[model samples]
Target: MTTTTENRHALPTGYQLQDYRLISIIGHGGFGITYLAKDTKLNHEVAIKEYFPNDLAIRENDHNVHPKSHQDKENFAWGLERFLQEGQTLATFQHPNIVRVLRYFEAHNTAYIVMEYEQGQSLSSAIKNKGTATEAFLLEIVSPLLEGLQAVHEAGLLHRDIKPDNIYLRDKDHSPVLLDFGAARYAIGSRSRSVTTIVTPGYTPFEQYQTKGDQGPWTDIYALGAVLYRIISDKIPVEAPKRVNAIKLREEADPLPPATKIGRKHYSERLLRNIDWALEIAEKDRPQTVSQWAEALLPPPSPTEQAKPVKPVNRITPATTSAATTRCGSTTAT
Candidate 1:
């Protein structure tokens, strides 16, 4: 799928950056432009990620990148360093579900990261075509995706952006490959300092839009829940901000029911409950680890296992809270 639309600002084809020749634009976003390029030296096609920073820089007629103004230069430089850091961090990831960034370099007054370009469609498009994803398909995609994400978190980095659109399903084995690093979003959000919002509406948790929201693995978990919700229901969840508003309102009606609630015939209760658990507006109410959430998606503990649990107690939610509206489970307006 075409990752981005509107030829807003992209380097023309044949443009050279080191040994890479720009073939075409693969994706474009506020912080960067991903291009399909040919590595003339290697004789291979690669995805070159350039630090475009649409909000901070622009392309001049001289074919070089420049900050929009003197004011943006500092922020632009900071974001550039972070982009390089993102490339360096991702270059070390050797997981199958993670996209590989082969190499990165600086040129044209900006940075570029060369990644292996997968010839496949994005999860978003796959969902659009299928209308609704099956439980088996959802598990097949999410479980391994979580493993990739676990690697990312262990590296001390966060992929603040984890929406369906950023997930590419490789054509070879239909395996999910995560695209886009959260470093860019964090950089942009840091620069704007509350003036600009750098988030996907439905996928971003309410706390994410806030610079001070207690973000962690759970933040990504919420977005993961939203993505699965979309895949199964084929509908966007209520945007985070609006959901927050409804929560505060208490009587304005919640947006949509949990996945199991809306997708009874389409999904199992265990799957839906886990999705709901991840989507708790409160960070304290969701799973704190991939393993914690994964357990919910699987069959509950066996009777003997429950009787003599070997694992440390992991509360799916605050114990004081019940599974009702006044408690943790009920998100009324269902």
Candidate 2:
């Protein structure tokens, strides 16, 4: 049998990985492959992510993943450990806006994270189908997502990758759920000589491209800011590297146009200003945390708005970041 990229790296349909039966491949990225699978024991669908960095490892005919070379073994094992760590950390949260990790385990010479399968189109698809999003629609999605992300940060972890495609809008309530965390990918890239820095061109900030970049809550803030820019302006912000290069040459202004200028008429001045603040080329200039940026993006509800009866479903509620840390992995529906 000839080996191609997808079939070579991905487990074939009907292949069983423990209790999960692979139905098909849903998505694949540089760090892993996400499969749509059925949990035979539970008799339900789930999304299982397998750690297989094609650059460092290859799938042998025996159906076990092995390092491409002896020199790559240490790096591959290090990344697998990090991948497992990410799943364990994520399994700690019970936030509604975050994707739920049901469990994680190791087999087939790699690791797998089983997450609750959500039915929805990605924010990228919604934007393409609906054109520019309304200020109301943007708030509905961003507010809840920020709370979820804040929880992740307070847990001493970072999502690292936040893009429209990584944000999913559930079909049931149109509520947003964050997906495809980049922590493992980012950690591996930082240490492995074979892998380059993990970045999504327009969404990644200037600092992410640097090996020793000072990343923190501010790093995620920049990526989320870029997501908002894409929604309101219907155009992606200029890539961060190009913007920084223009500054180095003593340019008078950033290569990317300010959100305030593009979204002023449709969105409030406060909203536009916050978007620009999040996308600041200098890390020092951006909002330092999710709460800080969200304050401006999401204002306090008015007396009348608060006085009204709150719907039991899909209403934004206040949550402390610490609360996210207290929960263990048992909250999702079976």
Candidate 3:
């Protein structure tokens, strides 16, 4: 992404004086700031993400800075389009494991996406509070996580950013809810002059470090593998090797630390193999679909655990209910 200098005079908290009642500041990032707000009409809490505009008007009015006359409008347009598109894309997804976008609107020259307010800790916080999660716990978390991704992949979208921070654990249902579709993209076409990288470095795919070409399911697979690695090893995968001097999987990349080292039994060889496959240098060699990865990780049902068949019984008589029992008793001589 085009690195713009931080706007020192820009508003730190992104709440306007009008419609939204800002509860508290939740988070901030390079592109925008998130706030916990209550919608006056609905009287319910929601997350309102305010997008920062790249336009000169925003710079001069909001930040007390000025952009040169020749500054590219393309960046502004791209940001606006992505901000709106993410809302539209997320609004269509109806899965319980994904955050639901309630509304999208532009006001005061800033775009906002209102979404369900989650009252639970993020995966990042969970990891911090308790060290590395146990294997069973990790599986419990990642299984539903993969299921959520399966929904996203089926919708023909890519969540370019998949990290602990973006994964929320809802206390109400005790299920994982994937959030922040801001960096998401439709995988069908190539993005133009967007010389910007949209994902975090260590969690991103090796190919994403390159300046050209579109990313697909393999990009997300690489990120998910990195996340799993960290949960299991309590260490982030070494920064995706440099693009120009990127190391191939078989050559210089380090072998993943064994699960046994982390106080867990050695996982099946197939599981380890698939994890390694996801971290492969070439996207083609990795599992092409999220469901494929899920299949590799999910254990098969046991024969001994199968449900027993119920034997069929011959009918003795037709059963009936009657209000007029006296007349029925009189006719029961047979």
lDDT of each: 0.77, 0.81, 0.61
**Clashing pairs in model 1?**
none
Compared to the true structure, candidate 3 yields what TM-score? 0.75
Q: What's the alpha carbon RMSD for model 2? A: 7.4
Question: Which candidate would rank higher by lDDT, 2 or 3?
Answer: 2
Which candidate tops TM-score?
A: 2
Q: After superposition, how far is residue 201 of candidate 1 from its true place, in Å?
A: 0.6
Question: Worst lDDT window (10 residues) for model 3?
Answer: 325-334
Among these predictions, the greatest lDDT belongs to 2
Q: Write the per-residue lDDT of candidate 1 for residues 1-334, one digit (tens) a residue.
A: 4445435578888888889898888777677888988889989889988888887888888878999988889888888889899999999999888899899998889998889987777777666646456676777678678878877887887788888778877666677888888796587676778424468888888787787779889988898898988877878888888877886877666676777678898788889888988888889999998777876775555575567635343422111111221101111111
**What would the TM-scores of all predictions be?**
0.86, 0.89, 0.75
| lDDT at residue 98 of model 2 (Cα atoms) | 93
Mark the regions of model 3 whose C-alpha exceeds 4 Å error after superposition. 1-19, 53-72, 184-197, 242-270, 301-334
lDDT of prediction 3 = 0.61
Per-candidate total of colliding backbone pairs: 0, 0, 2
Selected candidate, larger TM-score, 1 vs 2: 2
Worst 10 residues of 2 by lDDT: 325-334
lDDT of 3 by residue, 1-334 (tens): 0112334434444445246676666765556666777787777878877675333225445433232333434454456677788888888888777888888887655567888886776776666635445445656667677767877887887887888777776655446788876452321112433324365756777677556745788888888887776666667666665532444544543544543444345455555556666777577877888767766765543454234342222111111122211110110100
